[model samples]
Target: MGERYEYVPHRLLRRRVRDIASGVEGELMAVISENVSGVGAEHWVELAYVRGPSGREFTTSVGNIESAPGGEAG
Candidate 1:
């Protein structure tokens, strides 16, 4: 038997996610929200999705919808 500590893949991809929702609650700041209750006349949403291109396409949440104070969302 042998132990494996090394591994190789064809490609490597990494992402980082951060939520500043609580910090900008009702403050005209950018938010990542998703309607978990479904789309309707009375629907609520939660802060989900990351910041980047093709939003909500990755494991991240809250992006491209708004800017970070003095910066723009990329």
Candidate 2:
């Protein structure tokens, strides 16, 4: 994994992040891990829960998040 991916989980919590594909920006509320089985093995994926400005909530993959424009977490 690249350095950016490694730091994503640590830096994302309570911070404003944007969903890369959907262009949805919000404050990240939590990160959840889920296990999956594939190819004779198991792996975990990170899921991020975010709340948007209008109080809308959604979940997206951690891989889809990036720091929101403007600044750090308020």
TM-score (all chains, Cα) for each model: 0.19, 0.69
Off by over 4 Å in 1: 1-30, 34-41, 51-74
Cα lDDT tens digits, model 1, 1-74, are 12222222211112333335333311122233343443445443433333344343322233323334434232
**lDDT measured at residue 45 in model 1 versus the true structure, 0 to 100:** 40
The digit string of per-residue lDDT tens for model 2 on 10-66 reads 576888899887898999988777665456555767788889888988988888989
**Structure candidate 1, residue pairs in collision:** 49-60, 49-61, 49-62, 50-60, 50-61, 50-62
TM-score between model 2 and native: 0.69
Angstrom error at residue 20, model 2: 0.5
Candidate 2 Cα errors over 4 Å, as ranges: 1-9, 36-43
The per-model lDDT (C-alpha) reads: 0.31, 0.76
Candidate 2 backbone collisions, by pair: none
Positional deviation of residue 46's Cα in model 2 after best superposition, in angstroms:
0.8
